[model samples]
Target: MTPEPQAASTRADPAILSIADAIAHPVKAANFPQTILRFRNDRHAATIGLDALDDKRWCHHFGRFNPMPGNLPQPLALAYHGHQFRNYNPQIGDGRGFLFAQFRDDKGRLLDLGTKGSGQTPFSRDGDGRLTLKGAVREILATEMLETLGVHTSKTFSVIETGESLWRGDEPSPTRSAVLVRLSHSHIRFGTFQRIAFEDDAAKMHRVVRYALETLYDQQNGENDAAALLNLAVERMADLAASYMVAGFVHGVLNTDNMNITGESFDYGPWRFAPTWDPGFTAAYFDHGGLYAFARQPEAIHWNLGQLAVALRLISDAPPLIAALERFGPLYQQALVRRFCWRLGVVPQGMETDRALVGAAEALMMQGGLGIDAFFFAWMGDATPECPADQQGTEGEALWSAFGAVKAGYAPARVRTHAYWQGDAPQSMLIGEVEDIWAAIAERDDWGPLSAKVDAVRTMGEALRG
Candidate 1:
């Protein structure tokens, strides 16, 4: 039986007060004229105290589309420009989506309520501003999996299937349409700064930097200068990149526009989790050059950070900015070591020990061609680190010894009690599994498989957190 909805405990917050000047351009949502509620993420809604809303009330605010009290008066299609495939595109913006609202989470941190496929704005360059139902489903899975793995990512707030059909080149034509809302820490992208830099608007750039520092970073030490902000951003982005690497996630497109200033991963398009430890794995088919491959993700993010530094030059000199950019490498390396240790279910030792452990673990994965998720899940707590029969040779023994040395530092009683540790197979979200889940939905509209997958992923999350 479905559980009863809880009572509302929170209201909206006026967090994005700079929408009129620093960040966004006011716009109206497209008139899809039909609202069919399909999915609502009550778990995420409760983070901002909106989970108690009835279906009709939820649809009115997020679907039938009236702005909530203390939210933006109307949706604001944010302005920005980005480099697509390394080519600068000045005409890029929130073409189909808008910043619908802003609020504070339970932690009192500012959050954004953004949309995808809500409709067109001045940025919509002659295309139908709608999203296919399949797209919405894909995003939901992506965010859920990422969150489970402890990646800072956006939450899919609501998905309302608009009573319309969309024809697209990728999927089956005349596909069902839907509108999605995502809750994120911030919607201000690196591209937002790039746009002002491109226009040579120094005064506006300074204002944006100050606004971002105050609102997003919560830095009120009179250090809201461009150089200080860039320093903070570099550290955050490095940690974000390391999270992706350890999660075996390839974010397909790491474009400037897709990268938000808060370093949280959003806009899940063509994302994939590696089936095995293969650096060459590419998530997007069009990435024939392997620019954003599983291994090259750190490089892609570093390049994007360089572009951000270029934009910051509008407000600050080059020396401090360059110094800030120089910190990404060490920050990413340290973050990787820490994150890898956590995944191994061990308390991290010092940097040198952790780095050595990460290197040895990667070597083992590559040499044995082990499935990424399977290997991690199997060796989680070192309670019984067994080598596969096929991998019981000299090399495998050496790998096992190294792993054992690393695992000796942690106690296993915490995670051993979890039922997931007894499973024959680890919960994984490889391409085949995702496709199978989608096939179930597309063929018969059976949500059982998707629901089960979510539950399994959540179980894995609980085990890891313990």
Candidate 2:
């Protein structure tokens, strides 16, 4: 076996503690009956200097929720209120999770280690705090796939199967339970500000805004004011929405609480990849209104940003925040052109040509009912030689016309030489495939398939990054 990284450290820098105390509450972890190390993301762990931990130590810290040296003295469940499905709910917060620790990577970027399904807290009004093992597995798969697609997503760092059975209406009775740990830039959500605003605490709002500007947006040099933070969030969120579109992902839940101030995607629940170019595809069964549908994601993000703007009014006037909100449409349009071109493996021609090309491609996809993955996979770099027989037809001609206009002056951005490019089919994580992978683990405890899938995803990431 390869040796672990030698520079791994045991101490952590709990930066969230620097903020006000009203937003955090001390909580104790559930006493799990057993701790079986199921999955560990050593690649990401190495970045935070935690890869050297053995399974025993990993469980002690992640499973048992022990504090690392210099980390938070105890686990703290965060407080935040949000609009769940457009209904203002001030009673919600860290119901099943807490901020466990924080660390700085080798590049000096602050990263947070947070838990999910660790246990119940003051916010657990009428629910158990356990997580289904299957849920944990799905989150692992989702993060891996999103990361490979070049989306700014949280990393699923560790999962440990707790010796407990969870009962839920959605799944079969007494499903296996697990605890998950995710690595993200910040756990402070859009609702975090809303919570303080609801309390009419202007001082806390300013303090938290300054804290976010310093810890999360530190790279955004100069003018660390509320308006500047809102502008930065607008750009990041617009790009995030575009990345999800190009990746064919539906986050299922777009509540303000699920959206962090950093604009990174996390808290995956009932997320799905579109099987084809269906605009109204919905991921969650409970989304009866399809408010967060596949095609409406941009709208949902914009609406969430407006809520953030409303919260930020506690510190800044409406003019600047409204101005920041107005930029979303233009930013999203530009982001779509840029990200769509990147996925197509072509350098973007100017804005007008790129926009036309994207429009044509979308029209072709909808007209032909083409699979999202297949369309991008076949047309990457516009090589066409490897294009599937079914994807080439009269409808594609118009798309090709627009594509040619965009490609007239630019060469392909990536070569189709990677081994993954030679495969007969592209890597996809449709619900069927995800179920098959989970079925293996549920029936026979066979982890080979999951391991292989992660390896394939990382390899695909390498090819894309090249």
Candidate 3:
């Protein structure tokens, strides 16, 4: 969804157009071959209101549709690289992705909005640069749902589907192709620094660091010179990891290039919420080794930040950067504890009992293969009481015994629905019920049910306020 900006309009102005024009190099950064014509707009998207057929697209990605436009990097688009999957591949930049231009709001702050899957730049190398249409659709749902779930993620500006098929042998068959327009604060990945660091180019690495600090961490500019920006970046990375872990999220690919200094989450791929609290959940299809597992996401983020520190250390004094990085563990732990407490409807304090409560919740999830979304969304109204006989047992007992217990807070009429019996209860649960509600609204995009669900969740959490 296009976020509610501070009175920002979807349309472009002369200045914006000029920025687009200035950065219209099609094959500059890592020039690759082949640019196909697959121009379509995200039809089912809500950000650009479908009411105005003229406004039914993200013009930022494509000035107009169906044209293979050259993307010369914005005069300011700088180059860098990083490690992918822990293996240092120095030779990488925006090989496939490119920055569109910096979107300036009325306040005059620059938002480095950009696009991915806009086919083949000089960096395309051996792979196809174009994104499949299904991939585009998947991103639309994934990004939007994530936004609703309050995860830091890149917003899907547009998803234009193309009917053509693209091959990915990993799956059952070839997938249809399409392009996606992604809106992000910035697309500079951890790989950018890794590339320069790997190349032993201390100057370029430092330049990119200085550029990012000035660009993203402008708040630090007023403080003591370069040291402030470096410290700010380190702090932000820790903050990002902390937020992510408490949200039950695993990015599944915490590669160095995927890390952002600005600290907002971007680069969505095979990401997922933990279904079980094992911390071993791996959402990426390629992560057979579980390198970016749910339990390891926090560690992986810090490690990536460490790599960034190493790269920056090449240009600056290592001690301050090291000190900044050293604070990551405590920063992440504190943030995670506080956020998780909030998620569980509790006010956080450094209480041992409260920590045990959190552990108990995780232990329960580990015992039940509950879909994380379904679990929380359905748990919105009420939870069934545990059986008296099994009061002292584990979470599995609670899961099993609660099947016949009464649930409070909802209408007495909803008691039957909350009873988790195999023979009774709604044949279809909340997702299905929500789907039905959505169908009615899709007649005219009525948002009542979704809004109601949100309200109900708040009410339930408040009532059970710990």
Candidate 4:
């Protein structure tokens, strides 16, 4: 039975109190004519005790940009510098988005409600500060899919379509605009530290590191200082990189600013999931060099970690920071095997055996051009003793033989109950399918397909989580 939704409450917490002034600058939201509430994430809202907000009140706070009671009085456009495609960009910051407010979830963890396409700020260069409806829809799909696949990611808390048409170079001209609110662990990024380091501000860097340790890494003993923080960041980031690889996801732009300090995946732009197991699949079209390709994600994140280590030099010695950075490779490799084994519905024998299993699985995927999601979905929980008659060829023999060696002793019955596994294909969000889903919304204002897709994806998530 569905539970009754709770009423909206703006209870305050000691979240983001210290860094508000030091890290972010005040800004205003862009006023639009209409505030059509399109989506609200009730599950995530329940976690933060915000599921009780009625449509009008929800629109007032999210759509109209009126401050939530007991939250931040004014929106804050965070300050930071980032490397865009490996080139340092000193001027970039939160151009279209801002840190709207901070609160605590029921689990006692701090979370940030940040806005995308709220309004123009000092960071807004020559371009207008707006987000297209299509972009919002895509982010919704991306977050939902990643979450279902067991990746730590930000939730798309709310999406309100602002009644305005805007022009863009990528999509059709005069695209509909909307404002999205993302609920994340923290909006502080690697670039936030980079900005302070670039200024050569040791004291400010120390303060930022301390604040981060207190807010995000509360598990720490609060004694080790900057080096401790770097170690924690590296460990979390290694887990994050492994999650992406196992989920077959490609984050198109791995900029320093996009890499969250809490190691959660957010700010999805031009992201993609591989249809087949191709190591060279690139998500963003502008990525001509394939620097952030599917196979190179671990490398990309390791590079970003090095940049974080360099930034930590503002407050700590070089040797300890380097030592922390060196842990990424081993941590990532271990996490990759664990995550892969989980997806394959098997228990890992050990590092050596797990490594061999992973290598064999990848070989099968590449050799047969197997659909990444389909392969997992089909063999989920465990493979049957007999191979399918259609797959009795040499390729099938090699694939099943490699797979049989790592099959779990016991399979969970819950995974086998899912109807998705009964089909020949799995739920996928390839680019062509995403475009088709958007077409229905744009042409006829039909939301049936999109709604159904969300339901299917959520069901998949439930199966995976089980």
Give per-residue CA lDDT, model 1, range 389-425, as digits (tens).
Answer: 7777768767877766766765643456788888888
Report the lDDT tens digits of candidate 4 across residue range 418-464.
66666667888888988888999999988788889899999877777
Model 1 vs. true fold: TM: 0.95
Order of candidates by lDDT, top first?
2, 1, 4, 3
- Superposed Cα deviation of residue 61, candidate 2 (Å): 0.7
Each candidate: what lDDT?
0.85, 0.88, 0.53, 0.85
Cα misplacement distance, residue 221 of candidate 4 (Å):
5.9
lDDT, candidate 3, 1-466, per-residue tens: 5432322233321232332222233443222232233333232222322213333333423432321122223422334566678987755555546665455433444455455665566556776766654455445544554554445667766554444457776643466555556665666666666666666776555455556665555553343333555566667777677666656677777888777767768776666666446578887889999999888887888888888777666667777777878888777766666555554433455645445545555555566454444433333333444333533465566653343222221222122232222222211112244444535443554546544544444333333332
- Give the TM-scores of the predictions, in the order they appear: 0.95, 0.95, 0.70, 0.95
Comparing 1 and 3 on TM-score, the stronger one: 1
Clash total of candidate 3: 27
Lowest summed lDDT across 10 adjacent residues in model 3 is found at: 421-430
Task: Tell me the lDDT of model 3 at 315.
Answer: 67
lDDT for model 1: 0.85
lDDT of 1 at 313: 90
Overlapping backbone residue pairs in candidate 4 total: 3
Candidate 2, residues 1-466, lDDT tens digits: the string is 3343346543367889888396899999999999999999999988878888888888989999877767788999999999999999999999999999999887778899999999999998997888999999999999999999989999999999999988999988789999999999999999999999999998898788888888888844455377988998999999999999999999999999999899999999899999887789999999999999999999999999999999888878899899999999999999998988888888888889888777767875777556788778777874654223554666665555555555555568988999988998888899999999999999999999999999998988887877
State in Å the error of residue 189, model 1. 0.3
Show the colliding residue pairs in model 4.
6-52, 7-52, 8-52
